[model samples]
Target: MPALDKIRWENYARNLAKGMTQADAYEDAGFTRSKQAASALANNPVILQRVEELRTERERILSGPTVFDEDADTDNGEPLVEVTMEWVIERLAANVVSAQSTGNHSAANKALEMLGHHLGLSFSDKKAPSGDEGKPGSNLGSGNTFNILSLTEGLKQHAAALEQMPMKDVTPEDDG
Candidate 1:
């Protein structure tokens, strides 16, 4: 039960890191909230520590491994390299241009194919239907209206409301 309580506290902390209010995190973790009890809980030294720990862990996970070069060149001049998507794409493009200039048709074709695949212009998971078969409302594909911007705006509004709401009591039955 103590372990379970700690897990709940961690969950609340994670939620709080995602911009939820203290009261919202408290209620979200299935804990009952009194008039000022939520504030008291949020201020608890142990809970605060856990919250910081959770936030730090989340940051670490999101950041992944660092891209660093031990042989990095400064003004002294040495080998320097950066491994990034943009850098890789630019190198590929340069290779294609060089191949073309040198009349290396095979190398140019390979580089172009690689670039096209990376940019999702080639190699689809499913074979696209031919002619009218690919059209929306056809037997091959369904016509579904999707407005991503509208959906994102709706979610932001809902999240704002959730953040503003005060904590509420969580019954034992509901918690289970």
Candidate 2:
């Protein structure tokens, strides 16, 4: 293929990696807008390989640990740490305690809300209908009703389980 065509193909693959639709990527790569041509190129083995490479590279770049620094200059400050899900949860938990100690019920509730969400608790505005309603021996109550003590215990158990699990290392070098 010509050098310009190769460049266009690379651009098309890059665009695909960036989550563009095949037709959109083709047009964005300077190719005339044609669904048939886009489909054909998408199916090409060389283009497919290139697209896969670009996607893998993108994933590697995105999967790196995130570092949050309050100051732009990192020469003389606290050591940088990788911000993981556990780290975020710890921060939220701390915020909840801090807010509660300061008599900020609103802030404490907000922190607890965020912590609940992070812990996979579903907070739906609408309550789901419990099919057991109207059945014999069924304790009929609001569908959204839950035992706060049990829920809190369950969350504690879940947090303990998560703590026991090993964290996965996702560095690019580990791919090999």
Candidate 3:
């Protein structure tokens, strides 16, 4: 068999990297449309290597940071840093600390929760069985032990107290 044309091989590899089907790419590379021929060409060691190279190059280009300004270039910019799992975790940890220092308990809690979830230390709403089933004052086995009646009554009382109390502006001022 004669060696494949360099242009056709490059075209086929480019098409494959662009998500084209083997048969479609082979045809687009100026080859006769035959499923068997396309499959054979696609499975060729040289073609497969070229396709992998193209895919890797495409990924490198896509993962790079984008520059919005047409006149600006990234040639002299700082080295590109890939976003890793460790980097994300560190940022989240810093956020938790920063929020706590600023007296934002809610934000700190949220950041801590996110960090916990990312680290696989997730908190679940489902309660574990306590082996206290059928015991007095133990509502184990039945989902949720809190008294609904008492909860509703408490909420009503709290609402009434809030209505009786004087309202104050609690919104934080923008530091920016």
Considering every candidate listed, which one attains the maximal lDDT?
2
User: Model 3, range 50-108, lDDT digits (tens) per residue?
Assistant: 77776775577567654243333332222334456765665565556557668999997
- Candidate 1's error at 145, in angstroms? 43
lDDT of each: 0.56, 0.65, 0.62
Location of the lowest summed lDDT over 10 successive residues in candidate 1: 140-149
TM-score of each: 0.34, 0.36, 0.36
List, residue by residue over 1-176, the lDDT tens digit for candidate 2: 21124778878877876889999999999999998999999998888877777666556545777565443222212234567787777666656655776799999778777876665564555433677666643452333235334446755665566567554433247455
Kindly report which residue stretches of model 2 are placed more than 4 angstroms away from their true locations once superposed.
Answer: 1-63, 67-78, 127-144, 147-151, 154-176
Steric overlap count per candidate: 0, 0, 0
Give the Å shift of residue 73 in candidate 1: 35
What's every prediction's RMSD, in angstroms? Answer: 22.6, 15.3, 17.3
Ranking by lDDT: 2, 3, 1
How well is each residue in 63-107 modelled by candidate 1, as lDDT tens digits? 654343454542212234546786566556655656776799999
RMSD of 1: 22.6
Which runs in model 3 stand beyond 4 Å of their true positions? 1-5, 66-176
Which rank order by TM-score, best down to worst? 2, 3, 1
Q: Once model 3 is optimally superposed onto the true structure by TM-score, how far is the C-alpha of residue 70 displaced, in angstroms?
A: 12
Clashes of 2: 0
